[model samples]
Target: MSSIKYLSAILILVGLSTCGAKNLQEQNTLQQTAVQLTDKTTPVVNKNTATPKEEEEEAIALPPKAPLPSKKDSTTAETFNHSRWDRILQKHVSNSGEVNYDALRNDPSELNIYIDALTHNTPTDAWTKEAILAYWINAYNALTIDLILKNYPVKSIKGIKNPWDQKLWQFGDTWQDLNTIEHKILRPMKEPRIHFAIVCASISCPKLQNKAFTASTLEIQLTQATKEFLNDPTKNELTKDAVQLSRIFKWFKKDFEITGSLIQFLNQYTDFEISESAKANYKDYNWNLNN
Candidate 1:
């Protein structure tokens, strides 16, 4: 009977121990399931505690744009008026032949008019034609002088390139070459005096006249210019043995020779007798830009 009691006690103890282990295992599983549920419910955020996805969406919603002009702003006019230009021409002619450095530099509006007249407008009648051509040439020279004045202290006219290019010599509003202006406009009219009238701002260039050239006196003006330039000691000096002449005569020998020999051409305006020997010594041109 004692053996039976001992066996029963052992069996009871084993059962209790097994039940406790099962309970502990169930509690561990419950704790693991609770941790997994908490992990699924939690929200992820940046270190700054703000939603990174929301910040990115806000940045995408707004973008920068260019600023627009004010409603009251005005547009610029491209083409200048002719009547306004005519008034400027009047002022320009009044001060012709004389070098008005200040006026030329200070007044770009008037200067632009002069440039327009030269580059765009054409003289209709014979009288107006001569006047306009003379005006344009004078204006070109005057503007060149004005340009030099602005950049004064420079060694040469080549220092300023805007108007000096051979390509820029065009008719009003039309793109034309200097040769075109010379042959088409000036030559057809038989204005040979232009050879001596238009100054190119070179040491050997014709003297810049003090008075503006007008149609009424174009012929006489050109003639007198040729005569005066040939007679001026600074321009040309002739002696029995030798002659020192403006390098222009040497450079444009073909142009002068077309009408007559260079000596013959000179004789038309100068009283000084030049020998064939003098013509042979025709010196090379000094191309230094005349400021």
Candidate 2:
């Protein structure tokens, strides 16, 4: 009887162990199923990726840019107003680049207003190199107009008594002449394209553009005007192997040597390639006032 009772207790222990093992296995399977279901049902978010609408909103959310930096006057210069000159240029300079000098001379008030704006808005340390360039160009053209009106009915700009040398204009509180501005200021800027931008009130010179150069658009204006001047067949007379350039190139050859040769400079602005050893000469500069 004792042996039978001991066997019965052992059997009971074995059955309880089997039942616990089976329950653990079923619990593990249910846990795995729940995990898989959660993985499928829950949204998987990838922070790295964005929708297209988000990109458009980001692009459109930019703030308005200030024209001039809002800084103290002690640290900055006044912004130059080039609009007055633009208006005057549009009114007087024709679409074909012919200057109505008679009209320009008669309507001195607009020119005076532009000069006054220039005189007051002399750029300082706050100004950019572009601003300085635009200033001098407008100054040169305005003073040229003033000089022409002062002595109207003149055939050539050379007719004036040492026109370039005379300190005929007031630049801010200091006095400067056309020669000083061209040589001392703009030339040292090392941009030869100013040759095309600065008009000398002559037929041979670059045509007085109907628009004024502003600091905002100085770079594009300079580049475009240079290209136009070089590509103009009547002005440059370019060919496959020969180039008869304006007298301006001969006069300011050193300025165009940024690429080690004048041919390289001319090639930059011309569609037709000019040979490096192409026969180069200057045509006679017509000095008659650009009418």
TM-scores of the models, in the given order? Answer: 0.53, 0.73
On TM-score, the leading prediction is 2
lDDT tens digits, residue span 69-109, model 1: 44333232122223443354455433223333455557766
User: How well does candidate 1 score on lDDT at residue 62?
Assistant: 77
- Runs in model 2 with CA error above 4 Å? 1-78
Report the Cα RMSD per candidate: 19.8, 11.2
The lDDT per prediction is 0.61, 0.84
Superposed Cα deviation of residue 177, candidate 1 (Å):
6.2
* Model 1 TM-score (2 dp): 0.53
- Tell me, by lDDT, which candidate is best: 2
Query: How much is 37 displaced in model 2, in angstroms?
Result: 55
